[model samples]
Target: MPRVTIKEIARRAGVSKGAVSYALNGQPGVSDATRARVLKVAEELEWVPNRAARMLSAARSETFGLVLARTAKTLSEEPFYMGFIGGVESVLSTKGYALTIQVVPDLETEMAAYRKWSAERRVDAVIVVDLRVDDPRVPLLQKLELPALVVGDKSLAGGLTCVWTDSTTAMTEAVEHIAELGHQRIARVAGPPEHGHVWMRGQAFAAAADRLGLTGTVVHTDFSGDEGASVTRQLMTSGPDRPTAVIYDNDLMAVAGLGVIHELGLAVPDDVTIIAWDDSTLCRITHPTLSAMSHDVVEYGGRVAHHLFELLDGAEPAAHLNSTPKLQIRGSSGPPPA
Candidate 1:
């Protein structure tokens, strides 16, 4: 079916198009009775306002956007984004706003999305995640003059408003906890090194390990279960020189690593101990419930959405430290075998 136009409404209501417009828009030129008639005709015709026209008249899209430069499989399998998006929607739904999400393969495609959204005026603002060292998106978003909030540390945000958690502090705590548990040889199965938070965490992990006089090593992955399992297998089979304690960047990897440990006939906290980041539900359900750096990811996302609203409301670009993730010890972590 074709869209019902204002001209059609006018013809059916026996009024000029100008009068129909005035009536629909609640302008003073139309009498109450004429306005009532025109509105009734519009309802009967099932007419709806065009989004482009509404945006042109109100200068607001009433929407926000997020583009993830990750594969669809990763997005589907990752629990962090699910909780984060739910948090964002929790705030957006109340304000009569919508969220537009896109998944792309790389940063260049993600940049194209930003440019398109800017040219179309498709979103009132955008939420940028997974910041990189000297990120190009920061300058591109600035050049587009798009309102955006970065979900990263201030150093990576490049003067944009941001909401961040203290990953550095949390990493130190994880290392310290393992050190205190009597594990001197430690390993970290980290996410892609290019991500700002991952880089920061790696630095903090290294520093803390040195401070505690523990031998530390890190291997990077795509934050996938397969890669996590592969890395864990390699670490365990490396000719009697394997880490006694391992920390994973995300829960999926931790869970996968746990399976590989079990397959190798290793008992949790005996042959190897495990820790995961994000503290998603997966942690609790595992056989020997993995220890995790626990934080409210949903609330974290909500804070980012709130900051974007503040920015849209003409607030100054600023950074907010949401909270540091605390270590939630579980059965999977303990002292190494005596």
Candidate 2:
């Protein structure tokens, strides 16, 4: 038996080879009626178009790139991104698209990878995360003509479609909740300040403390459990008025903070109330289940992938979808000293 080709389909369908190629590739050129006829005859003939050949001929990379400005080890170990990226892959897989992922040490290395991959036409679109205030990636991505979805800071300008969670609002509410529970002095265990999401949350924690006439201090760390424990001890021992409430940027740090509290002979919620962002299952299984601001990371990833597909389809990306974080109260919060 002989294999069929687009040329054979064009001959049988009484259309030009270009028309058959356009119709089969789903590229716009042939009319709908012509496209249907070409497809119908090709299906009847059991002709399957060579995807690789068509990709090259049509200049379609058919891959969504994710350039991580962190190490692969960090990404694999972090639960937040594991869940989020899984969700993105869930959507991309259905569209017959593959994720072209890369993790680099710094912004410079990550930027270089994006440039190299994009210049080589290895990816159709890229998802940019960890955006900062006045992010350099926004303008650079625009210049590259690489359709991108930025996962932080809706306020970011320069035509990048933004998808973000309301971390600032979540932080303010978390702080206010602790203060209302009679916690006066509060401390925050923050991720790096360069991350836009972390900065927003930290700023909100500070602003909310100021507005409520409370003292708020922050400690920035690398979102590690060990660092979290160390920072918690530093804050607890350094101050005359030790904080009664602590907020962590991630669950790993929150867990570490718990260990620090125990080591210092402090009790949970009784001696110090703990709250964390990026809520995950780790918070639930802790000695005293943690109170946290919760958002659907899996669903958020799917939304991002959906937007990426829309961009690839030549539609202007939709308006940003801001995920709202809700307070999940548990055993970790209580009223302070009477």
User: What CA RMSD would you report for each candidate?
Assistant: 1.1, 5.4
Q: Candidate 1: where are CA atoms >4 Å away?
A: none
lDDT of 1 by residue, 1-338 (tens): 47999889999999999999999888899889999999999999888888778777758888999999987777788889999999999999889999999999899999999999998999999999999999999999999999999999998999998888898999999999999999989999999999999999999999999999999999999988899999999999886678999999999999999999999999998889999999999999989899999999999888888888888899999989998999999999888988
Question: What lDDT would each prediction earn against the true structure?
Answer: 0.93, 0.85
Clash count list over all predictions: 0, 0
Best by TM-score: 1
- For model 1 the local lDDT of residue 69 reads 93
Q: The CA-based lDDT of model 1 is what?
A: 0.93
Error of 1 at 313 (Å): 1.0
Cα lDDT tens digits, model 2, 67-87, are 888767667567788888999
